[model samples]
Target: MNAISSYLGSDHTRCDDFFIQAETNVSNGAWEQAEVSLAQFTEALERHFTMEEKVMFPEFEQATGSSAGPTAVMRMEHQQLRSIVALMRDALAARDAESYLGHSETLNTMMQQHNMKEESILYLMADRVLSGRQEEIISAMTSIDAPA
Candidate 1:
């Protein structure tokens, strides 16, 4: 089994792949494909966020006893990401490739920074502080219900 950083970092990569696929579809002027790809990307991203918010962050905070630290900042960042996602969705619905690309650029930058912090610091801390419970935590994260 992978460590928390490995597991969640892999997820970050997965979501990035989906985002890139959507962006490529948009750049190709394939609006139909872009819509489908964007939907997939949005769903995957939402699931990742839910896994963190409902399972990983809570468990990390419980183990570390630091509610207002990294997890809090992460939660706030999640909200920001979600807002951008909403705008992207609107752009997709309107078939506005330019607007979608703009939002995608913003999301890409934000995700890169957010993921660096999580992978380098927060996830590493969780790996150490919640060492013995790694399996339990990872199991919970994997089994979390995807957001509807």
Candidate 2:
């Protein structure tokens, strides 16, 4: 609504909220609730990543003509995050609390660093380069056809 940074950062917060709910449930040994929360978190997080990979990142890259730049780094980080998510999912399925906690800690740390880069640098860059096309970008991001 306010631009790329506000819109995407708010989504980051939303995903974080879902992560927190799942983490809390896991900590409480509430497997059922944790499963539900984690599923929601994974879905939302994947959606956010898809929006960036499919729409926002390409738009930013084309506008700036910097393929091997911040977007590339972000893409790499997304893959790493996805791998970590898979590990977490495995841990959840196995009911391995220790593994889940360890992976979750790694995830939290990675997300903090990754998000700082985006919210501070990449999003600002997008907002600057892709100026006036914010609404279209947001619409694409929100669209069902944007990505998974």
Candidate 3:
């Protein structure tokens, strides 16, 4: 895989693992562990989404000469995930396992679908549009996970 694809793919794998851990924790009545897992999941997701939104999306838009294409769609999907995450966090804080689990399941499904499309179709489109500068764009994403 090229640089952009590699970074996105790796992030997706990490997100998937955290989501699975969250599922296990919730299923086994380990609310505390699940809470921590959710925090980690949320942080990682924010970083990943920030990277796409701030750096990669702009680069892709510049390359493609379109502002309201694939990246715009992904941005909307991110907003959907963000709302669900906020609701899930509130539910978890209230010590409501039923609501939390329901929201978590929905979040996992939404995120999985989003990541798949981002990796397979959107990133592929970026790869073609970025010409040979995918590495620089990937490098620009490094700030995403930096300490804030």
Candidate 4:
């Protein structure tokens, strides 16, 4: 009986770990390691987003019959995060540590706020409304392919 909160909350931690590793590598001027860590972070984050957008959000919307609520807001925030990640990627490519760190700071702030909303509100709501189907939804989320 694993709740959506637990499943996705753990994923948040997983992504955060990757992000921290990437940021630390970049800070140390370990370009090669930074590249690898950043790639890992990006992949983990994209997978987390996909699981929510493709699986959990749809299920929650369908069950609740409200597509323009929290899911919409989360989607918008995801786009914002993606844009920041793109900037970080560009900075990384140019070996601009200052720029990359700046973007990383913004991204870290955004991710904290976004994850708070999800864990506090949306996920709790989903757990209540989509109770019995948690396993099914979690399974689907787990099976989704990582983003390119």
Candidate 5:
């Protein structure tokens, strides 16, 4: 299997599952559980994004002898995500279910968009540009822990 299919699939699966758990907690009005679940959800995102920004993206950029395209956009999206994520903590603290759900949906959309781009375009590019680090990239991501 290609790196995109072979690697990112598992990570995305777990992360998405966590997102659903967080959503459930919020839907049930379990603010405390939702808070913790959100934290765990964020951790999973951080772990995956960190691995990409630190390792895979750089390597792909280097391999292609350029760094001004897809990776840049991904970085920008990450910033947008962080901004929304910050608001989540406050919403959670206030037990503002509406606000919390809105933020969670925003985060979910961001992740879905980001993942779609990464898996469809970025990972394919990496599969082409990166020569020898397919397994390494995958392993790095796999080893990184989600929040809880």
Candidate 6:
């Protein structure tokens, strides 16, 4: 894997780990643990999105000179993911395991598809077009603060 793929893909895996932990906690009916795990998962995912939207996507768009391509699709998918997460949060607050699990399943599917597109396509193109600026982009992404 090239630098862009290596960095963002690793972050994706990290977010996946958190997602699994949250889902497992919910499955076990451990509401408190589920809350903590879900919070962690949300923070990690939001940070990943922020990194891509704030740093990587902008650089990729500028380098490629097009804003209506893959990055736009990713942004829209991010919004959908956020909406699902909000639903999951509401379920968690209501202590509705069935609702939470249903939303979690949907989230898992959406995330898998989203990550595949980014890892297989967008990241590959980014690695090619953003060559020689890998470190700079990575550095900028790293400097971004986690969502409040």
C-alpha lDDT values of all predictions: 0.92, 0.93, 0.85, 0.96, 0.79, 0.96
Which residue segments of model 1 deviate by more than 4 Å?
A: none
- List clashing residue pairs in candidate 3: none
Q: Where does model 2 exceed 4 Å of error?
A: 145-148
lDDT by residue (1-148, candidate 6, tens digit) is: 2398899999999999999999999999999999999999999999999999999999999999999999999999999999999999999999999999999999999999999999999999999999999988988988988899
Instruction: Please give the RMSD of candidate 6 to the true structure.
Output: 1.1
Q: Work out the TM-score per prediction.
A: 0.97, 0.96, 0.92, 0.99, 0.88, 0.98
Candidate 1: Cα lDDT at 114: 98
Writing each residue's lDDT as its tens digit, candidate 1 over 1-148 gives 5699999999999999989999999889898998888888888999999989998999999987889999999999999999999998898889888999999999999999999999999999989988988888899989986678
Report the poorest 10 consecutive residues by lDDT, candidate 5.
1-10
> In what order do the candidates fall by lDDT, top score first?
4, 6, 2, 1, 3, 5
Per-residue lDDT of model 2, residues 1-148, tens digit only: 5699999999999999999999999999999999999999999898999989999999998998889999999999999999999999999999998999999999999999999999999999999999999999999998834234
List, residue by residue over 1-148, the lDDT tens digit for candidate 4. Answer: 9999999999999999999999999999999999999999999999999999999999999999999999999999999999999999999999999999999999999999999999999999999999999999999998988899
Judging by TM-score against the true structure, name the best candidate.
4
Cα deviation in Å at residue 96, candidate 4?
0.5
lDDT of 4: 0.96
Worst 10 residues of 2 by lDDT: 139-148
Clashes of 1: 0
Q: Give per-residue lDDT, candidate 5, residue 59.
A: 79
Task: Give the better candidate number (3 or 6) by lDDT.
Answer: 6
Between candidates 1 and 4, the one scoring higher on TM-score is 4
